[model samples]
Target: MPNNGCVAVNDSTFELHLKKPFQPLLGLLSMPYAYVVPHEAIEYFGNDFRKNPVGTGPFILKYWREGEGLVMRRNSNYFEFDHKGVRLPYLEAISISFIIDKQSEFLAFLLGNIDFISGVHSSSKDELITRAGALNPKYRESIKMITGPYLNTEYLGFLIDTSLQHVSNSPIGNPYVRKAIAYGFDRDRMMLYLRSNLGYPAHSGLIPKGMPGFTDSLKGYSYNPDLAKFMLAQAGYPNGKGLDPISLSTTEDYVDICEFLQHQLSEIGIPISIEVIPGAAYREMMSSSKLLFFRGSWVADYADAENYLALLYSGNFSPSGPNYTHFSNDKFDRLYRKSLLQSDDSLRYSYYLKMDSLALDYSPIIPMYYDKVVRFVGSDVEGMNPNPMNLLMLKRVKKIKNDTYSR
Candidate 1:
């Protein structure tokens, strides 16, 4: 481990010598990030394999028509077997289409042309599900809907880097002003109306639901314009009389939510200007720490609280890692480093909670809502796991013939 996988693995048989105690979870995480590539094929494809993946998994890359679709067939040499000692991967072939239009994809699912659809769009959510969050009766018999928590937290990030500060005396530079902005927006209304009840209002801290370290009791910022106004006043911007206008940067997908925040904060005398940029540009600016205030999200890299809390670590500042906000607290930094050395789950989680709570107290980010993993599967599909990470374990999934819905 100290040599970073070089001298640690000395044998061609792939035996590893560890300098420290082995953490199985750290190694288990490789499953999600791993892909085997043929050494000789690298000279031919170079980096083009992203669109044309070749793997020794349950399926083989049969064909790929860029911007159109791709097809994969079962791997005859796949090693895994089911409980009955039968070969795994029941599906004969898997076809994935690169249709960018959500509406077109939904139509394909409705017509039984596609076997599944993941994450329904707001425009078509009501058409596929009832107001009460259930599959519409018209399609209940033909389709199977699965819903579960997703390890993602969408939030508004406040840039703490002094170089990126909007003005020398900007009100947002004050923690009280950031706190006011956090409590000004109604996340419940945003989730219900703006998101069509697709996600849960993030009343808790950044570690999303279904994560081990998440504590439901830790109530985060709530919508209270009166309190927000008071905080703004305390920060020397009463009624926003002489305060500089705050610019909120976001991409096209989150423009509506940013506009909603703009309207809500305006009520508290904080005028917010929306800066909608392309997604690529937004990410570039965010990574370079060029944006003052921005909308961002954290999806779990692995099933660990460290994956989310690492964003607030002082050592992970922007341009190096994901600490885009440049948030740093002495207590948070100390506890985060200690948590990594902890071998006990409960002890590690306690440290994680402390760091998470500290970040919320600093108001470096306003946690908006936690996303949900929603999948619509044809009735014929079986053994589909609606994992919080939204992973597709096709090796365990099987498709059967059903008269009502067969694609």
Candidate 2:
């Protein structure tokens, strides 16, 4: 294991010997990867907690059965309290079912068998939400809809590594060509029709909506068929005459979206082919640098700009790192490294903006949309707080009896 730039000074205190003055301490706190475990329990837990788990959280694992469900009981000794000094974890027990099909999960939610239904499925969206992207009037009284920005950015990555360039489609390595493709698609229409407005059209940089450094002013490529044609000519592929068919690699879940993109790009003379692979195989191909054009999403690991920017960092190339597109620019690399060391809060944000601008200029990836988290809960369920990270804090969640509605 690598050193964490931190050292124990005493039993109760520790010091972080950082490589830079600016430390992402707040971001670190929210990451499970940065968690510290009880060292003394290694022997007792056999270096694993598959069966016997331990935590100081608000719930305790009580029962788990394979292919069925799991149950957790509230921790009576939980240390949190409400403003009125009431104990946290108002609910006595929580149950989780291992349902594979999303339709089944939706049915369970409709039947009042679950406390909440989040990440609304496409199949159920029309039934639960109106075409105008509001909760259906019929279910509005019984279901409480909570919607907010989630820290996730979906994009299409372009392989900038010239080594992966095919003799037939050399234009894929050109920034202008990439920008042309970016400008050819209609993100607003996709969000409205395909996603049912579940997300915001990505008009910003790679940084998603609701993140600390995200800004609306960081301009992104929008739909413009004429500009796309001009860009293709500028990239030395007049009317996409010399360009070969661009193949896009993605999973089954996103095939429809890719197909839509293919149709839109074809109007600008860019022939596109859609390849739908299994999720696991698609990931493997991406990690192995086998796919040149692909779909990817970045969900914040720590709600920081660095988490998303790291994907474009040259040092983080795939197989060993997250830079699947193999995008590398010396200026981007220098600016990113400098951003990590700035101590001043305002200056650090400026550095973040500069790096984001560099990404926008290069067009290594086409920003699609920033995902929104949606949750529907029964009226009886209360005290739930919706956050950008979509973290579930069951400590304050509770279910109450209502004679008017059956549950």
Candidate 3:
């Protein structure tokens, strides 16, 4: 086993010898944080290393004009090669523009100024995709839309730890209240109307759709206004008679979704006020456990369901780990440890399901929807593939003009 997570045996050689086999290490290694950094680059760049990065990748940073654009040229001596033994990164250069408005970005792509655009903003979503979640027929010849499951679960969290003063007094501290909030809103409608069906309704659990360990065994909370009313009455706030307004902290980007929730929950006796905080400050407050109720998303750092489940593990309490809700259970912790050490696939997944069901029973978080990676590509480009992580791999991408295709 590594003394401190890893060991360097010699020059050009590094190894991780685990005492007990950990299956998710492979997924963890694929993350950017796992990249090997050269000591020379760190020593030379110091605090400015972000501006002056040095790494062994497919492309070299050519130029970056702050708030404008950045350019990268292909690395001729890149280590990776194709099956036919040709060096990769066939594209000569990669250009990226810092266009703030997605509407303007779509215009530039239509004018053939950019190769591709990712994600559809509300400003341009209706123009490109119909309510049925299909691209408009008018763009069939010039544009292409690619979409798939993204490994992200957006949700609303609660500070369930009774040790916190606000949590003890707040109505959200009541489990029935949380469950009522979960059942009050229509997640399917949220996806259909707000997202244009770009995402899957997260009715299963926090695992999200298309991700491993996600199961329907629990048949999670669906939109049931009647049941929501029942739960509110059980919580001693029938028709919102005695319930106080619960503030939902969020950023400007999610105000629409929050507003949608605000209106829906209000109908079933739970009044919610939207507190639109600046992005960075909101994140800081969320991590510090200052916000009793807040909107957050867990984008998997790896491909495994363990990455998502870690957010609920008691040992990972913030501001240390991702356990923002401070939910703790003995059986859950036992299952988590077992799953982490278990090497068998079926057994590990079973443990995952059990843990997720337990968390749902507690209702510390309200699942919104599993995100989807939507892409808009120009006909002039090819060789791009969408993945759950939304990674941008430009190695084999090529551009076409007239009768010739150029990389």
Best by lDDT: 3
Tens digit per residue, CA lDDT, model 3, 150-218: 999999999899999888988989999999999999998998888889998988889977677777775
Best by TM-score: 2
As a TM-score, model 2 comes out at 0.90
After superposition, which runs of candidate 3 have C-alpha atoms over 4 Å from their true positions? 1-5, 10-12, 17-23, 37-56, 60-87, 100-103, 216-218, 238-241, 401-407
Candidate 1 local lDDT, 69-181, one digit each (tens):
88989988898989999897888899999989899999998888988888878768879987656788988778998888999999989887655535334666789889999
Q: TM-score, each model?
A: 0.85, 0.90, 0.86
C-alpha local distance difference test of each model? 0.83, 0.85, 0.88
Worst 10 residues of 1 by lDDT: 6-15
Query: Which rank order by lDDT, best down to worst?
Result: 3, 2, 1
CA lDDT, candidate 3, residue 22: 74
Taking all chains together, the TM-score of candidate 3 against the true structure is 0.86
lDDT tens per residue, model 2, 1-407 = 13877666666564667665544566867676666555556568884565677656888999999789999999999999998999888999999898889899988888888878887777787798987578988887688888889999999998788766452256678888888999999999999888888899998899899988888888888899999999999998888898889898999889889998999999898999988899989899889888888899999888778889999999999989999888899999988888788767677778788888888888888889999988889988997778888988788887878888853
Q: Against the true structure, candidate 2 has what lDDT? A: 0.85
State in Å the error of residue 232, model 3: 2.6
Cα lDDT, model 1, residue 13: 36
**Number of the candidate with higher lDDT, 1 or 3:** 3
Off by over 4 Å in 2: 1-22, 47-50, 163-169
